[model samples]
Structures are given as C-alpha cells and as structure tokens.
Target chain A: MALIEVEKEGKDMAGTQEKQPVRVRGFPFYPHFLLREVVVMCIVIGSILMLSSLFPAGLLKPADPFDTPSPIFPEWYYLYVFGFLKFWTFDVGPIPAKIIGVTLPMVVWYGLLIMVPFIDRNPSTELKDRKFAVGMGIVVLLGILYFTYYSIVNH
Target chain B: MNLPDMIYKWFDDRFKISELLPPIVKHPAPEKVTSNPLYCLGGTAFLCFLILAGSGIFLAFYYKPTPEEAYKSVEHIMTAVPMGSLIRSIHHWTANLMIAAVSLHMIRVYFMGAYKNPRELNWVVGVLLFLVATTFGFSGYLLPWDQLAFWATKIGTGIAGSIPVMGPYISLILLGGTDITADTMTRFYAIHVLILPAAIIVLLGVHFMMVRIQGISGRL
Candidate 1:
C-alpha cells in the first residue's frame, strides 16, 4: 500500500507547503471507536449494577490477628502464584524454596511477557508465521488455569 | 455570535481544543483491527475502572481507616446507609471485572502480535498498569477489616516476605511494622485511594496516547 502524503502550510514566512507521509490507518475514531466504547460502557455499568443489587457483598466478622484463619488465600488472580509456590517446595541447594519458587516463576512469566516484542523479531503479524509465540502464549494461559484450579482445590 | 459562541471562542483561543481534538477524534484505525470485538477489551477494562472509581468514591464516604472502627463503618455502610451496599458491591465486582478485562486484553495483544516495533514501550506500560491495578485490588481488599481480608493480606504479604534478602524490609514497608496493625490498615487505605489510583490514571493516559500515536495493529 502507498503511504498517503498530506500537505500542510509551514510556519516560516514563506508559507511553504510541506509534504508529510501519513500511514493509511484504521477506521475513524469518532463514530467507530467512540460509539462502540459508549455501548460497552453502558453494558458494563448496567451489568455491574444488576449484579450488585442481586447479590450484595457480605461483610465477615472483624479481623482478629490473634486467631489465624485456615487455608488463607489471596484473591483469584494471585492464586496461580500461590499454587506455584505450593507445588515448588523443593529447595535448590543453598537457596530457600520460597525464594526460588516465588522469584523464578515471577521472573520467567513477567520476563517473557515484558520481553515479547524484543524477543520476537519476526516481521510477520500472522499467527501461523508466529508459531512459537502463539504456542508460548497458549502454554502460559493453560498454566495459569491449571495453577488457579490447583490452588482452589488444595486450599 | 452568541454567548455560547463567545465562550467557545475564548476557550479556543486559550486552550486550542478546537484545533487539537478533531485530529484525535478523526484518527484512523485499521479496518482489520476495528472489525474484531476482541480488540475492545482494553476499553472495557477502562470502563470498569471508571465504574470502580465512581463507586469507590461513594464507598469512601462511609469507610473508616482505623482498626477499631473500620469494620463497624463498613457494616454501617452495608446495612444502614441507602445504596451503600450496592455501591460497595459494584466497586468489588468491577475490580474483579477490570482484572479479567485487562487479562483478556493482554492475551489478545499477545496473540495478535500487537507489541511489535514501535509499540514495545506501550506493552511495557501496559504490564505496569496491570500490576498497579492488581495492587489496587490487594490494598482495597484490606479496607473492610474483615476476617477474610485480614488473613488474605497476611498471606499475601507473607508471600512478599519470601523475596530473599529484601523480604523483611518489603514486609515492613507493606505492613508499616511487623504485624497487621491500625497503621497497616491506614497504610493500605492510603495506598488504595491515593497512590495506586494516581499511578493508574497517569499510566492509562500514556497507554492511550501511545495507542493513538502508533495506530492500532493490523490483524493476523
């Protein structure tokens, strides 16, 4: 596709027209993006309101530091990390199990995610062309699902 | 011509909203990117964040930060104050939904390879935004001062405390001491309402700006 060249008047006294190349891009933001956003906003707000009314959040008894609860777990999002820590109990020689378990998975998971664009230098954006990237993504997704399930069941 | 026009002209002369906004509103997005509904998850997450912010502000009116009165205040909000329960519930559920939406958005970005080249920095910013949003959840979870909240925080911080040499110091910083005290509750409350929200808002601004500048990535 040819780049679209747009002409604009320059700020100099000559008032010369400068040609700038504009990348032919997506749909216009006004009606396309804005209208869809409005609809999504309404749906999200409406559903949340409906859900809240149907099932109000319950307050448990006041926190007691003296009495520790059994099977304490963080929110669902952190359950994968929790489960990873639980499963990787073996120590690596001098390193403590907790440190290795916590740091390793975090480093690997976050490292891979944050480093994706840098690591995958392939030019093609196609899925088939990026088999390794797609496979890795699927692996991470399944790992999260499995670990979350394990954390819940074991807890 | 009229009062409204005069006011608009005045503002436009000062702020240049008329000159600036049209280009942004009329920005072009790839047809392939715009066709897919999956690409909208980030906006959905942002919408949920807006709801959470509104409901959270409403909840804050009745919430107390002290250990002695925190639970009582929450109970009052839930039982005594009109629409308090609904507001609190919406805040809670929307937080979870935001996390879900962000996760799905990240996944879509990943599978679509939208993080390539000029968009790399935005991806990093996105990851930071995700972390800040979850931290918002963790901090806000403790505000109720309920049994589950206490235990969950204890374990969550305990996990943090397992970070080798920096563990103890990190725990100290998070708890504001050795244990979960009134100080800890106050700290969490401040972080939730002040620090995380500020960070998230700034990061969101950058993320959106980057997306606008780079344009949406083409479909696979």
Candidate 2:
C-alpha cells in the first residue's frame, strides 16, 4: 500500500512537470540568431557574384551525337557514380557486373543512406558514444573521395 | 512611431502582424546551435537555394528549351543578352555551392546523430532533398545542350538505363524515347524549370516546418 502511494506521487510529479511551461533556454531568433544568418548570406552572395564575374559559366561547342566527347564527365556531384561504374568490372552470382554497379551505388547505397537514422538505434548524440556510425561515415566519405579521384584519373 | 514603424503598424492593423511574427521572430534558437559554425551549413545551403532561384528565374527568361534553339539561346545569353552571362554564372556557381553545402550539412548531421528518434523522418526528407538537388544538377546542365552536356547525359542516362527492373522505364521517361532528342530536350527543360522547382519548394517547406516544430536536434 505504501509503495502504491509512492508510485502515484511520482506519476503526479511527472504529470505536473509535463504540464508546466517549457522554458526554452536560448536567445531570440530575431537580431541574435538572424543577424548571423544575414552575415553568412551576404558572404555567400558576395562570393557567388565574384565567382560569376571572374570565371563565368562555360558553354562548349554544339553537341554532335555522332562524335561523343572524349573524357566525358557528369556534374561533379555525380562523379562518384560515374567513378563507381568504372571501378566495378566484375559480376556476382546471377546479376551482371554492370547491373550490380548501377544498382549498388544508385539503388542499394541510397536505400542504406535513407535507412541510416532507423538503422543506428543508438540513442546517444555524442561522438564517442557512436563509434560504429562515425566509422562507417568516414569509410563512406573516403570511398567517395577515392572513387571521385579514380573517375578523374582514369578518365 | 517612425516611418518603418508606421508601415509595420499599417500591416499590423490590417493583418495582426504582431501576433503572426512572434512565433517565428521571437522563437528561441538553441545557444549551442548559434555558437557552432557547423550549424551555419544548413542556412548556407538555404541561402544558396535562394540565390539559385533568383538567378534561375532571370536565366529562364532568356533560355530556350528546344534542340535547335537551346544551344543558340544559351550562346546568346552568354554573349549578347545584357547581364545574361553574369546571371547565368551566378546561377551556375550558386548551384554548385548549394550542393556542396547540402552535402556538408548532411555529413555534419550524420556525425552529430541529430537524426535519431523523433528526427528520423526529417533525415529521410533531407536525403530525398539531396537526391532532388543532384537531379536538379543533372537535368540542369543538360539544358545548355553543349557537347559535354550531351555526352555526359548520354553516359548518365545510359547508366540509369542499365538498372535492373525499373531501369528501362526510368531512362525512357527521362530521355523521352530511345535517345536524347527534341522530346528529351523539351522534357528536360520542363523538368528543370517546372517539376524540380515545385518539388524543391514543397520539400523545403516540410523540412523547415519540421525543424521549427522539432527545433534543432543539435546537442546542447
């Protein structure tokens, strides 16, 4: 009977805590937070303008379907996919190597990436607490860098 | 009240601007988030998106989407149209920078484990946004219709077409037919100008709305 009373008291305390107004601990968004965003925006805009004035966007000669350009490259971001297609040359079981190449990076990798938050059930946010996730991220980063380099070099 | 205050008051009287703004303008930003340089990455990406949208609209005014007119129009924009080259260049550079910012932002999110628990859906939305951003890049460069653009897309679509079950259909839809043609050019233009922008705006709305609702997941 004593234990039940104590549990009810604890539940009541928890309920009141939940009911109380949450004092959001931080500075206001206006002026304090937004001032920094504005500064960053100015910097980003200035750099973009400077780059535009200097480099200017390039336009190659008119496309000729018959003459495929040598050393063709996709947009820089897609280079890893391009690189991977070039890197993987062997097949597994029934699926052809090319099929695996396309599916692995394009399909399978994306599935894995999208599933990250769900897969990493670790409740901790600290860097040291989530070693495996951090390690996998590093490996993926390095692999992408390596593949990007490979695409450029091998091209 | 001053001149600006009078204008604000005009709106406030009509629309209850005071009531509307407090949620957004006076909302608390986490102390750690404000101090941390890494937190700036997402905002940087958003700024780039704004720049891209502005410059893109300007470029679209001059850009023609047909096979015959596409390259010619781009050439005209580069050499003939007033401030066309500069606007186009700004669009180009901002597009690249936005992608970089998004990538770095995602990396930061991943390492920090900000995507756990209630934030999982936002992370998925983020990854989808990244995919959409890259698709924006892929579909975009093809609009210029340069030799590099043509061949690069051929390789890109060729690669896409090689996927297992849905490969052929995806490539066919993207390319419009067997190869990149007039149909493909117009289709890509429609996609770059219409489809992607609409999709991005919706996704961004959800992304920002979720952030505001959940607040920043960054460790305090």
Candidate 3:
C-alpha cells in the first residue's frame, strides 16, 4: 500500500493525474425526451385540422330564431344533466336534483377526501397508498355513471 | 509454483471482481409499479379536451356566427355536411366530459388535501379555470341561435343583471344591447372564441405548471 501511494503521488507530481469531480444535472426545461406527450398533442391538433377541412362551409338550413329544432338538446355530455333538468317539474317527487346532483355527491366525495391522509396506515410513497383516495375517487366516478344512466333512461 | 504463488493465484481467482475494481455498496431494489393514477386521470382528461377541440374546430368551419346565418349554419352542418351531426355530437359530448373530468379532478385534489401550503395558489387557479369553463359553456350555449338560445340568454343575462351596480351594464354588454340579436351572437362568438378560450389556455398552463412543480400529493 505504501509503494502504491508513493507511485500515485509521483504520477500526480508529474501532472499525469485525473480527478473525477462531482456534478449535478438539472431537470430538462425542454424534455424532448417526452416525445410521446408531444406527439399525442400534435396528432390531436392535426386531426382537428383534418376534420375542419373535410367539413364544407354551407351544410345546414339558415338560422331561424322562432324555430325549435326537434329533440332540443345541448351537446351529448350535457344531455344527461339537461335531461335531469327536465325532471325539474317533478321537484316535490321522490328525488330532488339538488340533493341527487349537487349536495349528496359533493358530501360523499368531500367526506372521503377528508378521510384520506388520516385513513392510510402505511403510506409508502407519493404514488402508492392511495387506497382511500381511490375509494373516494370511485364515488365521483359512480356519480357520473349514475347521472349518465338517469339522463338516458329519462330521455 | 511456490506456496505464495499458489495462494496469490487462488485469492486472485476467488475475488476476480475486486481485482478489477472495488465492490460497491448494494443498493435497494426498486419496487415494480403497476400504474400511476395521476397520469391516467390527467391523460384521460387531456384526451377528452383533444376530442372537444377537434370537433369544435370542425364545427367552427361551417358555423356562421351571425344571427342570420348561425341557426341556418347549424342546420346545414346537421343535415348537409358529412358526419356533421356526429361531429357536433362528439364536440358537445366531449366538452361536457371535460367539465365533468375537471370537476372530479378538483374534488379529488381537494379531498386528498393536495391543495395545502404550496398548493393553495394552484387551488385558487383551479377555481379560476372552473369559472372560465363555466363562461365557455354559457357563451357556447347562446351560439345555436334558436328559441332555446334566445330564452336561455335572456335568463342568463338577467342573472348577470342581478349583480347590482354594474350588473345591468354587464348584461347589456353580454347581449350587445337590450336584446339577443345579431349583435348578441357576435358578442357570444367573441367571448366563446376569443375571451374565454384565451383565459382557459393561459390558466391551464399555469395550473399544469403548478401541478408539475408540486408533484402528486402524498398518499393518504
């Protein structure tokens, strides 16, 4: 060991030495490495352009304020909710829209959310141990599903 | 070979790795992950937004914003244009879905206490985005140029007028006068295409930047 150190010292003195300096790399401001997300955005934008090009300028009848189109509807996603509004006339009936649509679902979701950070006994990572989160997540999802079902059936 | 030669050879062969390079401290093995729920939800909502934008841009191509042409244009798109109804349906559906997804995402964030401390500002921005999204909905609703649009705008503008002080002025600004006319369509069009979208785009950028910086909230 003594001999080896002496030889290495001699080499350093002769300016035949190398040092491995520690350095840190920062996160990419432009992560071209994230090609997948960029590609997806590009493809979506391109498709919109393609569809717009395919659609002709003059397709439907002229605007008439007095005319009410058949099956008067907002867009489809809104159809379910709008359909719920149609039941507004049934206010004093079994289920109220405010309770079913707004208050109850909100309460359930918030209750579950509030219970999350406290409920998990073994939270290992930022990603893992979302059991409670997932549980609460299901409530919102189910509400959407139920709303959609109600909309379709009522219509 | 002598004893030392034999011993040296044996030790050399026994620990060939150390002869070449010193052994490193063993690192803990990383656990396998199945899915990232944040990415999944965010990606899904993003996909829905893409769908909405695509269908919307297409609708815009044939959409005449003037009161004279607006209703006629929608009818033309529905009847004459190929897949017009389908496109319109997808556009409308996706917009509603985006709103639904965004709302759920916010609730999820709130419940998880993801908006605590450093995230509180992001929460405020999220609220702003929601307001902008509602405005987008309101502006788009009046574009159809029918009895529904007319009456709905009347009610909506009336609601705006209840705000006191500037309320009536705001309602007038929204309707482009006292009534829903060609001017009203122009106002809604400007809002839907220009004002609301611009606000949403800017806020969305900030919202996403905040999320990325804060990282996903810790498991509860």
Candidate 4:
C-alpha cells in the first residue's frame, strides 16, 4: 500500500508540471505580420517610389535604339563581368585569369558543390565535422566580396 | 444558442486549432537547431526579392516600355521624380546583390551537404531558379533602352540565332523579327514585367514551403 501511494504521488506531480501554463511575458515584440520581410520589402519599395516622384516630368527625349552613349556599360550588376575582362588581358597565363576570374571560380564553386554529398561522409552534428565546409564557404564569400567591392570602387 | 452566437462560437472553435492536435506529435523527429549566424543569408535573399517585387510594381506605374519612350521615361524618373535616381540605383544594386546572395546560399548548402539525400530535388529547383533569375537580369538590362542595353541585347539575341538546328527559329521567337527592333523590346518587356515574375512567385512558394517542411537542412 505504501509503495502504491508513493507511485501515485509521483504521477500526480508529473501531471501538474506537464499541465503548467507558460507565461510569455517580457519577450521582445514580434509583429503579427512577418516583421523582417515586411520591413525589408518596405525599404526597397519605398525607395523606388520615392525615386519615381522625382523624375524629370518634361525632360523625356525620344528613344533611339541606334544612338549609343559614351562609355556604354551594362547595368551595375554586370560590372563584375566588365571588371573580369580587365583580369583576362593575357593570352596564356597561369590559371588563365579570365577562366580563374570567371569560369574557374565557377567551376571550383560548382564542382565542390556537386561533390558535397560524397565528401561529407560523416553524419555527425559536431562543428568539427563541418569545419572544412565552413572554411570553404568563408573563402568563397570573401572572394565574392572582393569582386563586388572591386567592381564598385574601380568602376 | 442563438444563430449569431452559434456562428461566433464556430469561428472561435475553428481558430483555436492548436487545441485539436496532440501536444507532443512528432514524425521526422526534431533535429538539433543550428546556431549558425550565417543562416540568415537565405532570409535576407528572400527579403530582397520581396523588396524587388514591390519596387518593380511602383516603377511599372510610371515606366513606359517602348523604344520610342523607354529612355525618356527612365530619364524622367531620374530627374523629375524625387529620389528617383537613388531608387533606381537601389533596385539595380539589389537585383545584382540578390543573385550573389542566392548563389552564395546555394554554395553554402552544397558545401554543407544539405543538398544530399532527401534534398536533391530542392537543389534541382534551385538550379531552375538560378536560370530564371539570369533571364530576369537579361530582360531587365534592356528596359533602360541605353547604348549598352542595345548592343548587349544585339549580341545576346545573335547568340540565340547561333544555336544550330533551331538557331534561326529561337532567334526569331526571341527577337519577334530578324533585327533588334521595337518588337524585341516589347517581347522582352512582357517577359521582364510579367512572365518571369509569375514564375518566380510560384517557385519561391515551393522553395520556401519545402524549406519549412524540411526545416533548414543543417547537421544532417
């Protein structure tokens, strides 16, 4: 009888703990709508709308497809590719800088990408297991940053 | 209960859905959540795309996409519109930045082996998204109707014509004619402003839902 009572008491305590309500007080304000996505969307849209309001109302000249402007360059995004041509100013160099600048980095990036499933043989959750992947990611990220900055600054 | 009260109660019951499911329902099992700070890159890319869509809509309100008036409209937006140049620059920069971010995100996934096993299809979807994004870039490049746009598009369309068996057919379809004429701009405008956007919306939905279902493929 004593043993039965002890077990019953323990079960009662467990049930109470399980049923206890959690109080979500003092937490940061999380907006009902998607907070981050909404904020970002607003910034981007607002900036463009703001730009539209400033357009030269009567300054529009007729479009002529044949008229090419001086220093004709693609949009800012293509600046990287434009900058890439600068690096490719040789016929045969070590690594073919253009290939390395554009194609080879792409090859290595995508090649390493395709081989990932095979290379990551371990299923461990430890950070040590992911060190190589993380290291490679840092290198690639830094390279991209270098390219983007160079595009903007040099151009 | 009265009819109105009954309807209210029904609505309230339907809304209280968390009460229906068992509290501890588990299927795939909870994996350890990642503490990686860089995981936010995906979120950032998603955010930027949303921004692009909103801004593009606003731009569309005033944008006239014709070889006759495209450049003028862009110029008007720049000189007359308040902060127009800044907006254009931001949108332009963001589009490029987004491509970089998505590429980086894909690379991160690849290196982390997150693209293996059950995630292979997601990787394929990602490749399609990349292709669509490049097309978006290409189409948008011509919207300004500038010199670079004219020549670059001429070269690009010419490449389409060089595709061997269906080269001429492909070029004709893309150009809507033999040369870089008004028809070409119109087709590209429709593609830029309509088709790609719709495709992107659908694909983004799929990609995001898959991510949610699979729950960030880390430590797998």
| lDDT of each residue in A27-100, candidate 1, tens digit only | 56666667777877888889888888898788888899899888777888999988888888898899888787
Deviation (Å) of B119 in candidate 3: 0.8
| TM-score ranking of the models | 2, 1, 4, 3
Name every residue pair that clashes in candidate 3: A59-B76, A60-B75, A60-B76, A60-B77, A61-B72, A61-B76, A62-B72, A63-B71, A63-B72
Model 2, DockQ value? 0.48
- How do all models score by TM-score? 0.91, 0.92, 0.55, 0.62
Give the top-scoring candidate (TM-score).
2
Residues A88-136, candidate 2, lDDT per residue (tens digit)?
9998888788898899889999999999998999999999988999999
**DockQ for all models:** 0.52, 0.48, 0.07, 0.14
In model 4, which runs have C-alpha deviations exceeding 4 angstroms? A1-72, A75-155, B1-35, B82-86, B163-169
- The order by descending DockQ is 1, 2, 4, 3
The C-alpha stretches of model 3 lying farther than 4 A from their native spots are A1-155, B1-39
lDDT of 3 by residue, B1-220 (tens): 9998888788888877533431111111111101223333444466776676677889989999987778888988888999897788666655665676677777666555566655667777776776677677778878877666666566556545544356678878888788778888888998988787678778879977876666545434
Q: Docking quality tier of candidate 1?
A: medium
Look at candidate 2 and tell me the lDDT of residue B67.
Answer: 88
lDDT by residue (B1-220, candidate 4, tens digit) is 8998888678778786445332222111111221243454566677668767876887787788888788888887777887676667666766776787787777667666677667666776776687678789889887887767787677556644654456689789889998888898899999998999999888888987787576556453
State which candidate has the highest DockQ.
1
